[model samples]
Target: MEQDNRTAYFYLFGDNEDFGMKSCWIRNLTKAPEEIEVKLMEKGIPPMLTKEFCKFPEGQESLNKKNLEIVWMEEGDGAALLENGEILCVIPSWGGDRGFCGYARDCNGQGGFAWELSEDNEIRKRINNAISFIKEWNEEVNPFQSLQPQILDYYEDIFGESEKYYAIDNSDWPPKGLYVYEGTEKIVFATVAVSLRPQPKVEMYYEDASKVNRIELGIILKSGLTNDEINNIASLISGITAIPWDYITFVAEGHTVEFETIASEKFKYAVLTNKLKLLPEMNVPAFGNSHTNFLWIVPVSDKEWKMMKESGSKVILDKLDTIGEEIFSLERQEVV
Candidate 1:
């Protein structure tokens, strides 16, 4: 087995940029000096003084007496450098800002992907374990390659010509949702729930159902979306996932169904839970029914839910329509 041959580089910031310093490829922190000297010669400190400065108790006391400060570098912020000097992964400091901590990877120069740390205890523990694994990884072994190659290959294919893919770890913020973006526009917004106890099962649903569906319209109204509009929505979803799969599933009557309808059936739960709200005047008899021209799901936070309740259904529906059009326009421009 060949080793990864990658080195992790750590950095420390001083009181000013002039004193900021970086460490050599750090494989073991315990064996390295705690405080690294920076700009010692440039600061006019003699070579003899530099040698004495590293000489332990007296050196530390002498430096303190001269009002010189020694800054220690830790594993808080670092990057994995490839053998050829290309950066592999960006590592964030532990116990730092929750929003700022996560792993970022470059995908063969096609694009990149980032997974932000969620507040879930299990998820956070997994991230911590990942960091520890990177630190403890011996360069002489190939057992753990840090990241799965299949996952990287999958991202390379999905990103296509796009510049980047950003995914939020949904273990906490949105509960079970995972929202991914291409550039600045949202491409995939899905919520997935998994059951791991007796048997493993996955339930996934899109956040915006209408944008991912195609339907034959029997009646057209001023508020109804055109076929072109519906197609654009489907295109956006396809572009984000880069996977060729049917966004819509039609179940014929008398057919034994093992899976429930994602569009009509499960989406109602999003509404019931205040994650989505439908318009009363849409004239759709029931969600996922044959008569419905389009099925749309809107995500609302607790604060937005309260506001929607007070604003009445008509106002909420209008607001949602406006937002949907804006998002559609953005996606369309990106596609073009």
Candidate 2:
């Protein structure tokens, strides 16, 4: 097999002010020559560790006393440096506490792998190297794949422009909207449709003058339904239950629409009667006036609604509560 001859550079900085060993360079010469040796040079001290330097063991009391500034070794690359006129030495082999480590540094005579010098040029070089590594890793591991333009085109037709909308990763719900890099910039299309279905406020009222066991369930739909459609829906619901048509009222899109006449022939008709034939499996009814062309009303049991209200858990309810409070304050001239 052919040997890999790629080389990487690591920039090191020193602490000595008088000697000014502030900047130094380490060139990985693993594949260059077998006799290539590692050298550490200081102004006063003699050259230390002049032999073929490959790796060194941990806890070398001699080198520890010298207090090296930077050390990096990985695979076929290795180098070490020191400042303060200290003579640093090392053996040739790849094993120790710092074995196979890529980058290691010291600050104020402290030995560790963390790089803390933000103002130094060496630290900047290391940051650039890290950014390059991240970019390369992203390219190899999480490559940007362009979404099918046709799918985006369809959404663009319905929702207007593609750029105006944001992509959401619905794999996790409540459907997290992806960041620009993770979605739009990366060519990942937004797959979820946005629509307005204002939360329904539940109110209970007496069904009859007698005020017995029967109670009328009034749901105020703040938006997304026409008066006629609400009347038809109310009539249909009345037919299913023993509750009279007069008991049902739908506050559709800010206007109150009540189903008053149960016996009258004029109020018995359903515009979406044929449409309602496809029940249970296909309950979502689309109104032409809807901005999104569809209205989704998820039916929840009274027990579930009560539980959700008690816990303050439903996100839609929370949003609606905030909006209602703001609107109420504005209506009363409390907030200008």
- lDDT (Cα, tens digit) per residue for candidate 2, span 187-281: 21122222111111111232331112212122222233444543444444333222121122222211112233332223221111111111212
lDDT comparing candidate 2 with the true structure: 0.25
Give the backbone clash total of model 1.
0
Instruction: State the C-alpha lDDT per candidate.
Output: 0.26, 0.25
- Cα RMSD (Å) between model 1 and the true structure? 19.5
Extract clashing residue pairs from model 1. none
Model 1 quality (TM-score): 0.23
- How close is every model to the real structure, measured as TM-score? 0.23, 0.17
Q: Point out where model 2 deviates above 4 Å.
A: 1-111, 114-145, 148-158, 161-321, 324-336
**C-alpha lDDT of residue 13 in model 1:** 37
Model 1: per-residue Cα lDDT over 67-177, one tens digit each: 222221111223332322222223332212233322322111211112322233233342344344444445563222222222333333543232322232222211111
Enumerate clash totals for all models, in the order shown: 0, 1
lDDT of 1 at 14: 32
